[model samples]
Target: MQENTGAGYPGDAGVTDDFALAGVPDAFQRLWTPHRMAYIKGGQHQFKNENDCPFCVGPGRTDEEALIVYRGRTCYVVLNLFPYNPGHLLVCPYRHIPDYTDLTLEETAEFADLTQTGMRVLRKVSNAAGFNLGMNQGVVGGAGISAHLHQHIVPRWGGDGNFFPIIAQTKAITQTLDEVRQQVADAWPGETDAE
Candidate 1:
């Protein structure tokens, strides 16, 4: 707290000194301020609007319209809209349910099958040697879309992680989403199976 002159005492909160002590450059600090203000509070998320919810009616609407891999009776696979890698995909159920408990037995089975198929397709498309399969069961952990449950199959390569994500918060770069979608969709179940 900065010393307040005798007329009236107002706290300084130490914000300026804290940043200065930490050696944050003035040019870098000014550059980051505008980016912080860009968020629109209370904006409707894409999934919240059912009319435009891609996981529900969007997959069945068209083969090319949605990037769905296999449309099962209860669930389907779609390329991630924003992905960590080229072939990143998520297996989501038709019903907008949040957790594993909400999914029916058939829905669960379909998700499992699609996850396996997605991994296989990723391996072939990206020539990836390994995959990191995971899910966020609920909020308070990692479920960004807590109202809709899904599984991610992230294709891994030898040097996928360099210093960017760790040091500068910069992500590893990627190919276009359309190209990645085309590659995965083209290698449908009927296409090829590695022995």
Candidate 2:
């Protein structure tokens, strides 16, 4: 009797009599970040009062430490520490308001202005194909930091999304936060009409 050889598999090259298993070869590469476990596990600290909020305390921190890209009078732009994409940023009012309606006219204007500027700067610096820009208002709305109001500016590339994010729930941020912050800061527009 003839024995079966795994010739159907792409890279099997006819499995030997030793019964070794082979996998199909592909061009895809993987980037695993187990460190994100800490961010995921520390869920208790995410939805707290203003005093304990990162956005409330963020302005007081040094630009590099806080990953701040630009500081407007009423609003500021900061890099997202846990980014969905490489140059992901967040535009927020200094006030730790939980809702959009809580913003004053000045705060609202600057928030909109800074968000626009962040998109422009990200485009200039990273040459992003597009962006995902919006705010998650509450816990039910998918806000990780529900006590603070902030708009996310996620830069998107043509083929950035892949199996990893879908299958493993991992996003591969290509650049470090500090590196992206500096690049965006340098390319930021100066004295815009919104200012």
Candidate 3:
């Protein structure tokens, strides 16, 4: 048996020169996002009913309060509270319908219109190189809020995917939601042709 020296390995004689952790060197710099704990703890996505849904309540609030980028007659564009990347937006119908096929003819038209407008605005504001646009259908399909049908508009840059997301399972968002919301809202076109 060896005595625990407290400063180093049990066999070492209080010599921690080689094992010091305080000054260890590494290539990565941490970007602490304590705000994400809420989302992780289910504060943001868990809703008991449609009345408590963020998408349903968002239309009643001010644009800034709800982080809304653009509003159409039947659909609207809002920033994802928990975004996969910066400038990520969601185009949703005002109605709290779960599936895409549930959309009315007018809602469907406006939904498509808003999605195109979202892509255009993202390109104009953030110079997005490409996009990942889709909807996760239900809980089994990776939809965090499956009760609301929202199409994601994720802006992709050339090298946005780095070692962090793959190795550490952490995505570093460069902009605050408020900042993104304001920029997207300000850059939104006054009118988009709806079909």
Candidate 4:
């Protein structure tokens, strides 16, 4: 006959084993950032109007302050404040418009040109393995700032997707926005004769 010791059993409060007392630590390290609360809350207040639109306001500020990588006549490229990746860029038209179809012929041309140039510059500077390029049309379509039209140029690398973003809801940005902006700006292609 055996006596009950409450060892290695479920709901056993009497377990005195060291392994049971102190659970095993995970091999992975965690980066806990409470500061992201500001970013989460700030999203609601960012696009109330054209004046409040970051795409609209970014061009007016200095290159360093605005994180502007390149400025075209009708469109410009700026670094995403909350980037999916370090070199994430946004190509936005100067005119405040909600839809892509609202762009004029000139705006459309410049927008397309800037988008391609942005990808090229990002590849040159960051050595990106791939890219996630597109526009989130409206609020329902995953656009954070749906009031203004902007195309996202997210640079992706091998093994860039990881459990941290999925489990912790936190993205680890390797470089500062300014550092990435400078790198891309420095590597941007010079204006061709056709421009």
Candidate 5:
């Protein structure tokens, strides 16, 4: 802590100056997101084995509990627990494969289909103007959970980029993950229609 030498300020005399270390105020306003500590601290999202992998374990639970939007024979669409935007989604294969090349023919086909359906559902439910779609293969490739293969479908809108995400490294999600999951799930097209 800085020594309070009764320095310059309006009321310097006899004041304890508990916040002496706080220093001068600036034009920036801080947005404290305590919820993000889960990601930073390595919560359930961090998995050491396939048995605990979120993508593998998520399907065993109910759709609401898993934040799953849609299910197929070989793949499923679920809302991203740590989303870049409000309706960000991930299409993951049922198997615990670590890379895209590991997927079987059937898994590959369904994975691609589910990604398309997820994008359509996000557009219909959230009126998203654009999307960011890709897959992070391994730890070095930026996959948070590198034990599973999943494709990201991040919905985007005009002016979605703000000082918060760009400068502060924080994104302001307008809705809860469950809310987005339900909206996207309800808007999902039937199997026949999706094709």
Candidate 6:
């Protein structure tokens, strides 16, 4: 066994680095990949109106199931199909407007509620050390689904990093979305569905 570096890492001496980690997640940095970012670009289909939005789809659509976690008359939360972290999620108003001004006062309050709920649930399930919360409002601002503005709430960890994004350019996820979904779903029931 190798001695720990006392810097929070085990010594590398005699350590046979397992390449299989590339598949199973040995480092958080390798998780970010071109395929992932390309999808994050969120510019596949351009719609002249908000009607073309997938987030706007009804729950009964029977297509790609809307990852709606919490739903109210005006606002709700959804799991990000493409995520920056395990519990990455989106909070938005049901109204199909890109401009933030379109959301009513009640809807904004619900949005705040959803954000708090999402953070609480993420903390319970992932044991996450931190979070990255923001909104990408347009193509110029990194909005993939710019037609309808949504807030992204990303869960984070302290050591969930490596040289990949700075070097090889990847971000490795140590947990599976399935596992993440299950844990987050179970953490606080209503984060996925409103109480």
Best by TM-score: 4
Show where candidate 3 strays beyond 4 Å.
Answer: 1-48, 192-195
Model 3: how far residue 108 lies from native, Å: 0.7
Error in Å for residue 52 of model 2:
1.0
For each candidate, the alpha-carbon lDDT, in order, equals 0.71, 0.81, 0.84, 0.84, 0.81, 0.71
Q: Report the CA-based lDDT of candidate 5 relative to the real structure.
A: 0.81
lDDT per residue as tens, model 4, 115-181 = 8888777777789989999998877676777889999999999999786886778889999888888
Candidate 6 achieves a global lDDT of 0.71
Segments in model 6 whose C-alpha atoms lie over 4 Å from true places: 1-45, 61-64, 165-170, 189-195
Q: Residue 115: error of model 4 in Å?
A: 1.0
lDDT: the better of candidates 4 and 6: 4
Q: Which stretches of candidate 1 lie above 4 Å from their native place?
A: 1-54, 166-169, 191-195
Which is the better candidate, 2 or 6, if ranked by lDDT? 2
TM-score of 3: 0.73
The window of 10 residues in a row where model 1 has the poorest summed lDDT is 35-44
Per-model TM against the reference: 0.68, 0.74, 0.73, 0.75, 0.74, 0.67
Model 1 lDDT per residue over 1-195, tens place = 575556464346544555554565565522233332222222225556556566676665675667676677788888877677778899998887777888888888878988988888888788988888888765554566655788888888987856565457567657877778787888857625543
RMSD of each: 7.5, 9.0, 9.2, 8.3, 9.1, 12.1
Better of 2 and 4 by lDDT: 4
- Where does candidate 3 clash, by residue pair? none
- Candidate 3, residues 72-109, lDDT tens digits: the string is 88899999987888999999998888999999999999
Better structure of 1 and 5 per lDDT: 5
